[model samples]
Target: MRSWAEAERAEVGRARLRVSVLVALAIALMIAFVGGIAYVVMVHAQETQVSRELRYNARYGVPGIAPRCAWVFVLEDGTLHEGDLEVPRGFPLRDDIDAVHASRGSIERDVKANGTEYMVLTAPGADGTTVQAVFDLRYQLLDRAHLLLALAIALVAGLLLAALVGLTISRRTVGPWAEALARQRRFVTDASHELRTPIARAHLRAQVLAAGLPADQRTDLDALARSIRGLADVVDDLLASAQLQERRDRVPVDLTDVAEAAVVGETERATERRITVLLDHPGRPVLVGGIETGLRRAADELLANALRHTPEGGRISVSVRTVAGQAELVVADNGDGFHPAEAERLFERSHRGPGEGRFGLGLALVREIVTGHGGTVEAVGRPGAGARFTLRLPLAEAGLPVGGEHMTGACP
Candidate 1:
């Protein structure tokens, strides 16, 4: 399973891909729209030029012009007079001439004769005669075909170039996000390492001083020691959360033993607070595959969180069992419970609820450890009622049993 950071990077890549595709589509549509307008303008211009040349030939006949426009003159009595211009064979026949003469006003029309296209124009001559002129449209049609072909090639080339440029821009745009994430991870790792040394030295010095103190001073020294321990625990949690991405070593672990050992370790703290800590289990081994140290730390954090919240005389319970091919650990505490609205945010880093003397790192560490093991952790609670944290991890294969004795260890 990919880590959350890796999954986020993948999602960014997908978003970049979507942006590139949209950009390419926009470029393609723009080219098509512009190309269509240019095509229409060019066709209209060609038609207008053809009509102008036909009208000119009708009024003042050109003799033997290139590709020859045919001309005819009709008197008021409807007598036909063919002009000096030579009409092509099977073109501008008598019926075409009559249609042109019968037109009421100056107008242009297209006619096809013997597989050839012609643009015809009709107008009244200065001498009370009707004039008609026809020009061949083959060359104009061929030019339009070439223009369309050129536009198509341009459209394809433009689309490909747009796609290439879009891909490059997308990569450049997402690069900063990747760099920022890398820097954040590095800072967390370096800062956590730097903090561990001083905390360890302070904890050591406190232990020594507490050992030498007298009975009356011993309580104050012990309290100081506990405070130092809590600080160390925070440092450890920060280090573990930072290093989770780097730790992938897995082994078969007995969760039942881990839960029992975590309970034993917190027994002193619970007793001091007058809270009842109960370990409920069938004593049967529950096997899971994960990092044993990380799993133990997760269990410890859960237990610590429960102990910290439970009031004096309140009950805390820890249990481990296997259900539906998964190993489950449940930690419940009867204390001033949290609001249901805040339950989901309880495991977020550095988020504190309505409580005093809370560092807010315990539940976050537990969430990180369990998630690193390809497991899930959830909290459920109602105000003034109680809170339950449940963790579910995939069980190891039945034949790959790890002994509980090997899994027994003190929580960090």
Candidate 2:
């Protein structure tokens, strides 16, 4: 039990770790995306500002600037003349030369060897010549990078705060459900213990009276004894339900052994009803989890159900085998079949078959026991056809693959 509890806690912890990792990754991506956009916008804005400044400086030559008109030129015959002197630079242009030339606005090139950017603009000169200006732009790029770093730090702090809040909220939401389940279990354990005394006494009294009654009164006494037996079955179911609610962990058992025991017990009980019991094993031991008593009681419930519904000479077969690596126990009978829809509510407490007195809680108790053992129980029946009750239990660790089979899709 302790080991099962520890395993559940470990599973929860792993889920929490996975969620935290996903949250951290999301936060990182958000920071990177926002920071990258900010950096690009800052660089473009700085480049536009430098272009405008250079254009204004070119149009008015700034007063007292040397070479203000010295390098101003005219182009004729596809050749440039600089102030009536031969042009030193070409009329067209060299792409890499760090010289300013002008058309509508001045254009210039300024290349730095280490860690700097440059911008250029060309404009129409005042004397119908062209002027250009250039300026370094490395400072603007560095400023944007620093701003992005600060923003990212703030966002990371915010994400941490949000994650903490989310964790607290989730814990509070699920805590009540956990407590309620625990309380219900304890109640079942206590209630079953209290109810057992009277039921045992009643059974004993019935047995005593049956032994002492004369033949003339035996018929009446037999009816009374049958009623007592019916009551005993109900008490048994209640006790099983209590056990299931109390133990959240499963106790391992061998299904083949359980099926063998059930066959013997059912055969003895059904002798008076003329019901036949056939037991089949796969010849291989299939290990599963559940208290032996609990599993037997569950199987007995199904057997009793089949005996009651099935006509005389109908056969009941109990089979235990391995299916998809899990222990599978099936109880099938050639009984007057049931409605397919009823299969779902067949295990519900207080449900019964048509024309049958009241045997609803039997299947319900069976389900509770199977579920508590970390197994599953299901009923399959169609009208006018035989019925089948199937139980599946997870395989022991020794029987599982390297990491153990996943039970997610085993049952609802």
Clashes of each: 0, 9
Give the C-alpha lDDT of model 2. Answer: 0.63
Model 2, clash count?
A: 9
lDDT of 2 at 333: 91
Query: Which of the numbered candidates is closest to the native, going by highest lDDT?
Result: 1
- Candidate 2 wrongly placed segments (more than 4 Å): 1-113, 116-137, 175-179, 196-254, 260-277, 282-290, 301-316, 322-327, 333-412
Model 2 misses residue 342 by how many Å?
11
lDDT tens readout by residue for model 2, 1-412: 3222333455555655556656666766777788778777877887777666666655544423413212233332334433443333332233321233322433465445345555544444544554434445667767877887787776778578657754664456545654565576567656756666676666567667877978787765666665555455554444444453334234456788778866765665567667788889988777775455567678777877887778877888899999887888999998887898888988788887776688579888788677867789988988767899999988766633222211121111
Q: How accurate is candidate 1 locally (lDDT)?
A: 0.74
Worst 10 residues of 2 by lDDT: 403-412
lDDT per residue as tens, model 1, 342-396: 9889888888866566788888878877887789999999877889999999987
